[model samples]
Target chain A: MTFVFRNNTIERFFSDGEYAFSGYDDYGAVPEAERYIWWYQVPVKYNQEQLITEVESYLRRLQWAVSQVGQAPFLILSLELLYDAGVVRGDRRLVNAIDAFNQGAWQLAAEHTNVSVVDFGAFLKQYPAAEWVDWKFYFLSQMIVSPRLAGAFGQWLQTQERALAFRRKKCLVLDLDNTLWGGVLGEDGIAGIRIDGDYPGKAFRYWQEAIRELAHAGVILALCSKNNEADVKELFAAREMPLKWEDFACMRINWSDKAANIRSIAEDLNIGLDSMVFVDDNPAERELIRQQLPMVAVPEWPAMPYLLPAFYDRLVKDYFAVYALTDEDLKKTEQYRQNAGRAQAQAAFTDMDDFLRSLEMELTISPATEVTLPRIAQMTQKTNQFNLTTHRYTVDDIQRMLDHGARIWTLAVKDRFGDNGITGLIIVTDCGAVDTMLLSCRVLGKGIEHEFLKYVLGQLKASGLEEVHALYIPTEKNRQVQDFYDKNGFLCTREEQGRKAYRLSLADWDEKRNTIYKIV
Target chain B: MEQKVLMVLRRVFKDATIDETCSQSNCKAWDSMNHLNLVVELEMEFGISLEPEEIARMVDYAAVVEIVKTKI
Candidate 1:
């Protein structure tokens, strides 16, 4: 259950009983809860001086409460003045005091990953300022928020909580004709298409700018249009639009079924179909995708061009808002583009060994440190395809394992194309049993997993370890790695219900590493 | 109209055994918070507003129906 620290009656807003509240204006002696919430509104007072003092005390109490909660999530709602009783005009003291508290909350969120600030002003903006509080209800029940808006408040709070968890969609696939520009490329031709000069073109220009910003924020862009490839390429070169040819990680500019094209784009980018959002101006195309691929999200397109900006806002709020961005997220688009580059480079070489050696791959393996711990935890949570014994972990769980003397190493793979940061992880118990092993799909085609395993086992043998144990737990997406241990010369000791256990003797294991890549 | 009140009471109190005889002194679920919720739901259900005096006097189901009948 979540424990809430509030100064007013907010139990009506969070009516699900999954929450426990503190006493009126209580911040002392916090009870143990799975998570915590702070929703302190500005206490109504006639004197401006007294109100400022009360609002100022909230920041200190919040800091103490945050410190007491340790690593649990603390959601703090910014203080909003529901009923301002100030009579003097041009009063700046109260507003400035409220601003200071909100600013301090934001600073705490920046310092700690577990602390997040929810914008309470966004919800209050929906209603008139006069209707924020009902005097009768306020006197009767001490509720600062109107009981009439309880339903809307509950829904808004749930969306904010979900956004805090950050399960944002990964890719945005676009349709070309009328979706990105005013006119079709196949019919209007390069010069005839309106993209830069008229009323409708200006609207499309703004929409393209919004989509480009989404790409820089780490949402992969793709194209699925029925226009000829040459025509689209010519238009991209001729028009001075916000999007370019290189912005899209993959494109299917052929006369093919849109569902099949979208599926191909997902495969090309190495992402799941569910993590994609498709935008198209044509309703028929949108309906086809909705029916054929139910997992992909198809948002309703606005009929008029001017409504595109509002539609973009709804898309971000619904699908792409995260609590915060990591360095890994900021570099996602570049990494996906590099994967496409490596694919083309593979097609040019006849020998697999030659391709591996010519890439100048470098693998750096190190024990988990403070700098790489968050990335390591994130990889364990997200990687699915190449994982053996699929086990998800958070930062706190990994820190506990490290305290117990478990050996956890992270592998950073860099090649001529780009740097895929901290893409592989191995967690081994102190007794030399492999608890978890996973590699991101971006760096999978070059035989790095086997080389990583051999290197780790060689280290164990050098330290006078005798045997190593491993297991392959079956999952829906990890079926390809069922015999991974068996292929690496591990003896399968037990096999039951799609689960396999293997043991390897370090004394007799081959310690040969692939000479193609440099290991440090 | 009485059955509508009974249904709203059942939903807000989360108790199916509630009938017209349920009152604040006897019912365990009709506490202060649920009392506020009931007022909000009644105003929304019957499109009427309740004064503070009427809400205070609505300690029993009969009083609740009587106040709502005068407003609508």
Candidate 2:
């Protein structure tokens, strides 16, 4: 159950049994629970100074709660103090205090590993001040947040949960013509494509810039357009284009059907088609992808170019929320692009080993440290493809696994282009069973999975272990890795209902360390 | 009119078992907030905005139906 430290009566908002509250603005007894939320709304005090003091006191109490809470996630909500202080235009005291209090919350969040600051103002801004504070409910039940907006707040909370849990879609597959720019690139020349000066052009430019930020924050960008390859490439070559040629990790600028191109883009990026968000302005293209690849998230493109901001916001809220970017996630776009470059160069080499060696990929395996625990737990939670067993773990859960004698090896991979930091991991029980093994889609297609497994198993073999066991618990998104253990030669001991268990002797691990990887 | 009031009551209170005997004193779901929602539903159902005093006095299902009828 989650515990909310609230100032107002938010019980009606969060359902019963799902939450237990600390006294109104009271932070005395810190509850020991899995999820602790600081939801102290701005108190409705009349005196301006008193209100500021109350906000400050709430801030201090929140700090205390943050200190007392367990490693389980602690969410601190920013306070929205825009209640009646209406008509009193000159009184900036309450506004300043609210801003100060929110800043302190954010600072606390930055300092604490478990702290997450949810923007309450973002939710409150949807309603007017009068609607936000319903006098009837306020007088009757001390309900500051309007009861009418309860349903909307619930939805916003769900979005925050998705963001907090890192259940974000990984890649964004974009349509080039009317979606990214204002006009058709094939019809309009490179300079003719409307991306600036005009109304729609300015809006599209803003939308493209937002997408660029998503790419930098680790959402892989891909181009999937029906225009001639040369036409789009020439447009990308333009210096003023908001989205650059190099921004996209992969491209499918062809005359073929969009779904097929999207499928190939997913293949090249080594992500589940489900993890890709397909955005196109053409209704026919959108419908084709929807009918053909239902797993791919297809958000409708706004017919009016001016509505692009709203459309972009909806996409971010739905797909590209990077809750906490790891060092690898921050560098993902560049690494994926470099991986594409490596993939392209691989065709030149006749021998597989020669092609692999040309890339000079480095794989470093380290036991899980306190610093890497969060990312490891996140990988377990969010990673779908290339995962042997889908076991989502919290930080406490990961710690418990260590206490229960589980040896977790986190793998860090880097090549010629950039460092894909700590992208692969394997957890093994003392009895030599692979409890969990997964590689971030970024590190796949390099044959590093086998190398990671071989090295980890080699460590086990050195520790006087004879064999190891593994399991494949398939999920909708993890079907790509269903035969993962089987292909790696883990003899399937049992199979039922698509859930397979396997055992492999350490003696059989053919020292098949792909000579391509400098494994350490 | 009575049936419409009862239908809105069933929805707002989320209790299908609620009938004519249902009142603020008896129904566990009919709190002040639910009362506000109940008043809104009544107004929308009958296309008449009940005064604050009228909403406050609407303590029973029969009272809601009567007030709604008077407004109509």
Candidate 3:
């Protein structure tokens, strides 16, 4: 569950699912199930001294929350001093206080792996400071932000959530010629290219510098250019070029169709085609890729080289801006390489079931304890694609469930090559209501979640439960699981507006757990 | 032109009951920050720039319409 630490009355702005709060800025005992958020809006009071003190205290509270959360991610929206400075005179004190708060937040996030700092200043810049707060809502409900900008604010917050969840594009495939340099590579040979000097070339140089920063931030850069391989090699060898060819992780320099080339790149990298961004100067190439590989993102090329900076900004904002990088993220390029080798090895198997059976998968199912509680709560919050009931729960709520006699089981799956730890969870109420069942997409195609659920059902039957009832709550991302319960031999009792309710008699239930997977 | 300006203000303030009497002193929603937003929206909507002096003088709805009319 998500917990919001709000200073102003923002009940109308945010949804009811988020726990709204006010009063003293402190993180005492953060409940194990709740993901903490620091959402304090800049106070509009005239007293600069109190504002400075309160801002300093907010940093301390955030630091304390980070220490308490341990491995769980804590989202901290950067403080925005949202008031008209013209009314308050030249008060450098407020400016200094806001700088200190933002600096403290960035420093803490750098030190703590779990803490992520989102730039609230960027959103604040969309409107003038004087127009940010409407006094009518402030006087009536103490709303910090103007209600008129609520729709824009909600969209920005959704982008923030995507960043926090690590749902970002993995690779960027760039085109050469006018896209990278100032002119076409074929028409203007290595010496004739305008990459270093004068108007349009200067802009191209700046764009290259920005892309180099993206590469430094761990986005795998690739080349998918239709150019002479030998000439491109010479260009890379030249010392005058601003960007080196070594910056790219992979290159596909050939005369072949881009759609075929992108497909080959996906095979070479072993990453999903959906996680690629293709940038090309020619609209024809971009359109071809878009038509053939629709999952791949094709950003429109700027008409002028000078527009590259703005284009780069849009690229980072839309695709590559992640909240924080994990250890897995740093080694993602290597992991993709390994997956390529695994794909080749799996070709020897005769059938799909044979390929899965040969993996010798092991699943560990156990009661939810302190170690697994946070992941269980997080799974409930973020697992939209494969969730059965879509019932979101907080750490505090899960702990309360345990205290009130709810049995929660988490499944950790491991195959021969790697261990996808704690990928599925099932929360069964004592009253025989299966409230939630969800699995991470990493282990979905293997049918591990189904086997895991069947094992739990078998155990529940042995423990004196006569019947088990379950529900399917449909969401935009969870259409794949609509017939999940029906497939498991449960009789559907109700159906309405994409939601389905089902019940199963334990006596008549089939306890057919897959023999390939060993339940520990 | 006056009706268009009023429509923008009403939408920004989220108060359908707003009229020409709305001003910085009388309308609570016309606070400092929102005052700036109203100015920006008006500038973009009417395609005109209001000087700092004229912006400050536009305290009430009647004054806003007068100042906006001169610029447009």
Candidate 4:
């Protein structure tokens, strides 16, 4: 179950079953839950001293909660000062206090691994102040947000939950012509395009800037336009505009069906079509893509060019909301590019194994200590695709395991190009049971996780462990890891409730690590 | 006009089966929280601003339609 610590009337906006409490000023026990949400809005009162004291107390309360609930993910929504303080005296102090509070939340998140800070200010920017607060509702209840926005807010909150679940789309497939700019690139020459100068052009410029920020936030931007590649390329070269051609990782600029172009873009980016959002101004193109590829999200474009900001908000809220960024997510584009490079380099070698060996991969395995415990626990929580058993563990639970004589090993892989830090972990109980074994999806295709496991098995065998038992628990997000134990040579002993248990004789196990990965 | 107000309320409250008997005091879901939601929905649906007194007195389904009708 999820719990929310709120200062406003957001209880009605979220899922019905979730629990919420009043603001930090209210003294109450933090309820028992798997996750916690900090949804406190910036107070509307302009009392500078009172606001500062309240803000400080809020931080203290959050700190107390964090100390109490160790290792459980605490999702924090950033504070946004929504009200216009023009009517009140000493407004700057209130603004400063709110700013300090937001910065503190970010700092706290950075310090604590389980804390995730989401920007609520970005969501608040969607509506004007007049529409944001309704006097009638404010008088009825202390609810700061107007009721009229409940539908949009509910949809936005759902997107945020999806984002928290780590289910954001991988690529954004964009359309050119009036979609990318104010005018068509083919009809209006590179200089004649409305991407930099006046009213509509400035709006498009703002839109491009927003898209650029999305790209910076690790969303892979791609282009799918029915125009000459050279023309689009030239427009990007013209220094008048803020966005460039090279800003996009992939492009499908031929006069082909948008569905086919989208498929090609996904293939080029090495992501599924379901992980793509197609944006275009033309209804026909959007409808065609929608019919052909139902998995790919196609948001309706606003009829007026001036509504691009709103359109951008809809796009981000619906598709690109993320709880937090992982190290793998930050280097996703680079990793995809590396995979392409590896594919090209593979043809030069005589055999597949020879090519793999030539990569000079190194696997570093050690028992998870104080430094690597967070990554280990995160793997147990988030590693779905390559997990042997989908066992979610909190930091406190992992600490308890260590206290109970469980051996947990975390593995880090490094190649010539880069280091994939603490990508996999295995927890083994004293009774020869593998409690959890999982690897991050980024380093899966490289065969590093297998070698890491084999090295651990060799160590266990040397320590006189004759047999090991393992389990594969099934979850909606972890279907990809169902046959993981079988692939690793463990014999299935039982299957129940879609979960499979496996046993392996370590004495008879193959102790050979892959020649590709050098174990040190 | 009353029918239009009821239609708007039903749609906004997301209860197609709602009737005149439904009100804030009687319906469990139509408390202060949903009252705020109902006000927002009513305002947006009818394109009118309701005063605080009218919003406070909109306790039942009939009263909801009456207050909304006065505003329109």
- Who wins the lDDT comparison? 1
lDDT of 2 by residue, A238-329 (tens): 74867898889988888898888888777666678989899888888889889999999999878799898898888887777544567768
Recovered native contacts, candidate 3: 0.00
lDDT of each: 0.90, 0.82, 0.80, 0.78
The DockQ score of candidate 1 comes to 0.75
Superior by DockQ: candidate 2 or candidate 3: 2
Q: Give stretches of model 3 more than 4 Å off.
A: A15-19, A22-37, A65-74, A84-93, A106-116, A135-141, A162-166, A324-520, B1-72
Clashes of 3: 6
**lDDT by residue for model 1 (A1-520), tens:** 9999999998889987599999999877999999999999898789899989989889999999999999999999999988878998899899999999999998889789899999999999999988789877899999989999899998999988888786589999999889999887877789877677777999999999999999988899999999889889988998899999999988888998999999978877778999999999999999999999999999999989989999999899888876567777788888887886777577689999998888899999998998888998899899999999989999999999989878898899999988887889999988889999999888897899999888888888898889999999999999988978987899999999999998999988776788998998
lDDT of 3 by residue, A283-306 (tens): 999999889999999999988888
TM-score of chain B of 3: 0.93
CAPRI band of model 3? incorrect
Q: Score the docking of each candidate (DockQ).
A: 0.75, 0.20, 0.11, 0.49
Error of 1 at A183 (Å): 1.6
Give the distance in Å from residue A20's predicted Cα in candidate 1 to where it truly belongs: 3.6
Scored by TM against the true chain B, the candidates give: 0.97, 0.94, 0.93, 0.81
Interface RMSD, Å, model 3: 9.5
Point out where model 4 deviates above 4 Å: A1-170, A176-207, A226-256, A264-275, A300-314, A317-362, A366-370, A394-408, A414-418, A446-449, A462-465, A493-501, A506-520, B1-72
Residue A209 in candidate 4, Cα distance off native in Å: 3.5
Error of 3 at A431 (Å): 43
Candidates, ranked, DockQ: 1, 4, 2, 3
